[model samples]
Structure formats: structure tokens, C-alpha cells
Target: MTHRVSELTVAESAWCKSSYSSGEGGECVEVATCAAAVLVRDSKRPTEARLCFAPEAWAGFLQMTTGH
Candidate 1:
């Protein structure tokens, strides 16, 4: 299941930028882990909507992306 970040109480410090990010502001994203889900938001617009994914689903996504 997925939820919006607005529905959860995630701390600002919890967000971490992707290592692949150039840090020069080029389509970067941030991720945060919570008890119920893993959250994703645009690095440039964090206050906007954020996508939350179940832990299992997030693991699956990583596995698929990494092909490992």
C-alpha cells in the first residue's frame, strides 16, 4: 500500500538525497524511511506531494532496478 507524505509524520532530517545525484540540481530525488513506508520526493520541491511505498514494495523496486 502507498500513502502520501502529508499523511505521515516524517522528519526533515530523515530525507537523504540519492548518491547518483550530481548535487548540481539535475533531477534529483530524496528518500526517507518510516515505520509504515519508504517515502520519495523531489529534491527541488519537497513540500509538494510525496510518494510512499510499502517496505516490501520498495525492496522489490530496488531489486528490480539493481537486477540483483
Candidate 2:
């Protein structure tokens, strides 16, 4: 259920950069969580389309990425 950021009312303060993101600006990613979904966007282009994921699906993605 991915969607563009323009479709949601996410606050500016809700966005956080990925812990692994380097301050140098390469591969920067940001995530914002709400009651219904987790939002993912490119930190460098926040006005662009964003990806939305169900909470459960987001958990699975984290688990797979962490290999745990």
C-alpha cells in the first residue's frame, strides 16, 4: 500500500533519517510512523513519492534486513 507523501498529512517532525545513513548525503533514507502505516522516503527528495507499508510488513522487512 505504498503512496506518495503528498497523499498523507505527515508532520515534518515525524520524519527521521535511517541510523545507517551517512551525513555525507549518499543513500539517505527517512522513515515516519503513524497509527496505520510506516512511511519511507528519500531524505534528499522528500517531496517525491514515498512508500507506505503495513506495520506487520514493515516488521518483516526489518527482520529480513537485520538477518534476525
Candidate 3:
């Protein structure tokens, strides 16, 4: 049941850029964690739609991406 961060929720979110992001900042993503979901959005266009993931799905994605 993942969904984009609504205007109301966005007001309460604390987004953080990826640590691996370059200082030049060509393109990167930002993430915010909520009580039951993980929110991801492009740093360049934050006002655009975001991609949300359930906690379990997010953990699985990290595992696959990190090859851990």
C-alpha cells in the first residue's frame, strides 16, 4: 500500500540526500522515512510525484541493490 507523499505529509517529512551523491549534484534522489513507509523523490524536481515503498519492500530493494 505504497503511495506518494501528500501535501499534508510532505509538510512533516524530513528528506535526506543519498550519501553517495556527488558534490556537483548532476542528478540524485532524496529519501524520507515515515512510520510505515519510505518515500523517494528526485532532488531536482521535488514537487513532482514521488515513489513510495513499504518497509519490507524497501529492505528487499536495498538488499538486492547492495548485493548483500
Candidate 4:
């Protein structure tokens, strides 16, 4: 079931903007929850691209990206 992040219920899914992204307009990234998976999308071209990952993968990605 491919679900768009925008279509997700914000109340249930905690949406967050990447700390890496600042006031810069060119770079924009957002993430939200979907019970079983994590949803990611670009705020710049929201409709252009999006990706999903499992809980473990998302955690790994965060660790890698954040250098933690």
C-alpha cells in the first residue's frame, strides 16, 4: 500500500523537518510515521519524489546521516 506522506493523518504521524535543513529553500526534507514504516519527502518538490523505509532502516539512516 503506497501512501503519500501528505495523505497521512498528521495527528497520528509525527511530521518533522530535518535538522540538517535550515532556512535554505533549495534543500528541504520531511519525515513522518506510518505505523509500520517511515515516510520521507522533499519539501521543495513535494510531488516529485518520496521514499519509505522500515523502522530499523530509518534508524540506521538517521544514525548515518546524523553521524551519531
- For candidate 2, the per-residue lDDT at 4 reads 53
Q: Cα deviation in Å at residue 56, candidate 3?
A: 0.5
Tens-place lDDT per residue, model 4, 1-68, is: 55554565544246677777767576878887768678787877666656877778999987998899
Model 4: runs farther than 4 Å from truth? 1-13
Off by over 4 Å in 1: 1-4
Backbone clashes per model, in order?
0, 0, 0, 0
lDDT of 1 by residue, 1-68 (tens): 55666788778999999999997889989999989999999999989888888999999999999998
Q: Lowest-scoring 10 consecutive residues by lDDT in candidate 4? A: 4-13
Error of 3 at 23 (Å): 2.1
Task: Point out the worst 10-residue segment of candidate 3 by lDDT.
Answer: 4-13
The model with the greater TM-score, 1 or 4, is 1
Per-candidate local distance difference test:
0.89, 0.86, 0.80, 0.72
Selected candidate, larger TM-score, 2 vs 3: 2
RMSD, model 3, all Cα superposed?
Answer: 2.4
Candidate 3 ranges with C-alpha deviation above 4 Å: 1-4, 7-13
Which RMSD values do the candidates have, in order? 1.5, 2.3, 2.4, 3.6
Q: Could you tell me which 10 consecutive residues in candidate 1 have the lowest summed lDDT?
A: 1-10
- Winner by lDDT between candidate 2 and candidate 1: 1
For residues 20-53, what per-residue lDDT tens digits would candidate 2 score against the true structure?
9879878988999987789999998998889888
- Which residues of candidate 2, in runs, are more than 4 Å off? 1-6
Candidate 1 vs candidate 4, lDDT winner: 1
Ordering by lDDT = 1, 2, 3, 4
Error of 2 at 44 (Å): 0.7
Candidate 4's TM-score: 0.65
What tens-digit string does per-residue lDDT give for candidate 3 at 1-68?
Answer: 54545732644349898898896967999888888788888988988888888889999999999999
